[model samples]
Target: MYERKPVQSWLTDMDGVLVHEGQPVPGAPEFINKLRSSGKPFLILTNNSIYTPRDLQARLTRMGFEVPEHALWTAALATAQFLADQRPGGTAYVIGEAGLTTALHAVGYVLTDFAPDYVVLGETRTYSFEAITKAVRLINDGARFICTNPDVTGPSVEGALPAAGSVAAMISKATGVEPYFVGKPNPMMMRSALNTINAHSESTAMIGDRMDTDVLCGLEAGLETILVLTGISTRTEAERYPYRPSRIVGSVADLMDEI
Candidate 1:
């Protein structure tokens, strides 16, 4: 069992914690509104790197969330930030959606079709065999492999779909190259989220639905972890895990009773 603690800042997951299958989870909006009203700064952190912050903000608005652009952070953004810090001005061979490409470009990276200095992978609906082959060849040619996240799948309107990790793993197996992951459970992602709020680990809490990624990431980063059952992990499943959250709630609405 885990014990609850006080927190000054929050880093929250989006898909499972706030919404599911394009619909807002019950009490998500209220919980967020309360956080905002209380002046407890929070960021919407997500492993899905297919959309930019602006795109995500628009989607949240469409789903009736009063979200600001700066409150959003995606794996794509974190990956770009990490790459920019590691190898600035490098050309990248990208296998992801427009958002990942856009983030890389914003970080002063040039996107190329061949012989890139780095190979970047994320979520892409149009991923093809040729793209995978090209990425593998580039890795074999000495390009650094960078994966936006390690999530094998994410919830979607149709159901769970293949995420970036699955594709990255396939390429890694083919080329015998492991990638530097930039999403949840990785310290880099947690660091980026903390920087957004200008807070330290002691003052921060991670509220999410998944145990493997979100809860584990929060624990690794030394932040209080709050698990909400509104998403993927059920109470039964969560109980079976060795690593438990500091607190567990039925939904975001239940947060009202806490903070």
Candidate 2:
């Protein structure tokens, strides 16, 4: 029988596992403190591409979570990294906020709509019809389609708003071209994250609140997956899936000792 190596690094989802509705989850702060004190390599992962790591770091600081910008990873960064690897110094027609645009710029991607290399879609507060129309026409013209993530709806103070996936669907319907998503549940995201931290899969653990994205991505990335109940998934709901997490805990607080 083979044995897994002891966990030396950690990757955790930011929304449900750490915060919900703009409030920090119980024991989340302590867990973060523990990781900091232990000097263990850790990252807070999120499929949200609206905000850059610096922006997210500030948001977390406001919420009393002292997370550094280097400890944060967003789908925007992952998508930009993937694109940089696939096509160095490429041009893209981008539809997103500062996060996605800034990331692409950092990776030497030129954002334009005129016969670009790719039509990249990401999360935005305002999804304009004109922009979507441009994206659709561009894809029909020959540009490849790429999406930051496949989340259909995102939470807001009002309610769930149509997200990147929803807009990607409309574009796909028009052009009959489906985009390649580079965020959660895609093992590529996990691999990129692991590479970012220089952590090995066998010695890293993933903590997530969702089975569809976080747990699934971690499992596929060969990291031990820990499902927590503070988010969208419940213990019962998790069992409905074919795969199971390595462990299930009430919250991040439960694993404080592990760090």
Candidate 3:
């Protein structure tokens, strides 16, 4: 018989761990409700920079999850916080939705096209070639390049759509300058998520659906990693990576007892 360690603090990914294809994963709400009732800190982590915490909360609510707006943490918020620390009161030329723009605005960053401090890229419904061309020119003209996440594509009803990383690559290819990617697979964003809840890596458990991003983020950030098969990653796919998750479950439904 094996004795499972207790979860002191928890972090779970949004898309596949809790909900899949805009619907709540079976038992996700119960798991979340357990976390909420237990009095321990928890947050749903997302690499998406297109929607704000409030937006996510509402979406989750519509899907039957009662997550608070504060219970969600996004890559956009982390990127804005990073920029604020790195270069305070700076200007940028941004390509993103309200989530990215709002986060930057809260951090006192001004958005402009002319002689900005950075050319920040994020997830958007449409990636305009004209905007990307301008971004390349901005990089050539000494503006630093930054991207919210490194996800090359995102899931859609129609299939995977080109996302922030893909657009960033285009700009980089044109300008011969690589943009700094701040979302998962990068440990900084994980650290920021932990910091947001004042949680320690040793005691915190990170539940994610993807091995490359979620598991990697947790492992690199020094947190225990759990991989759920409810999303894009599979059991065999997880093994292909050099790094392994601390545990792998079929779905969030299988995690109730452990938590």
Q: Is candidate 2 or candidate 3 better by TM-score?
A: 2
The residue-by-residue lDDT of candidate 2 on 108-181, one tens digit each, is 99999899999999999988999999999999999999999999998887889999999999999999999999
> Residues 1-259, candidate 1, lDDT per residue (tens digit)?
6454577888899988899878999888888788888887789999888899999999988888988898999999999988888889889999999789999999999999768889999998888999899999889999999999998986767777888889988998999999989998897798898997897888798899999999999999999888998888998899999989988988778777656
Where is model 2 poorest over a 10-residue stretch in terms of lDDT?
Answer: 153-162
lDDT of 3 by residue, 1-259 (tens): 5443566999999898898887788999999998898889999999999999999888899888888899999999999999999999999999999999999999999999989999999999988889988999988999999999999999988899998988888888899999999999899998999999999888899999999899999999988899999998999998899999998999888978866
Candidate that scores best on lDDT: 2
For model 3, the superposed segments whose C-alpha errors exceed 4 Å read 1-5
Cα lDDT, model 3, residue 62: 87
Evaluate model 2: give its TM-score: 0.98
**Error of model 3, residue 19, in angstroms:** 1.0
Best-to-worst ranking by lDDT: 2, 3, 1
The 0-to-1 C-alpha lDDT of every candidate, in the order given, reads 0.88, 0.95, 0.92
**How well does each candidate superpose onto the true structure, as a TM-score?**
0.95, 0.98, 0.97
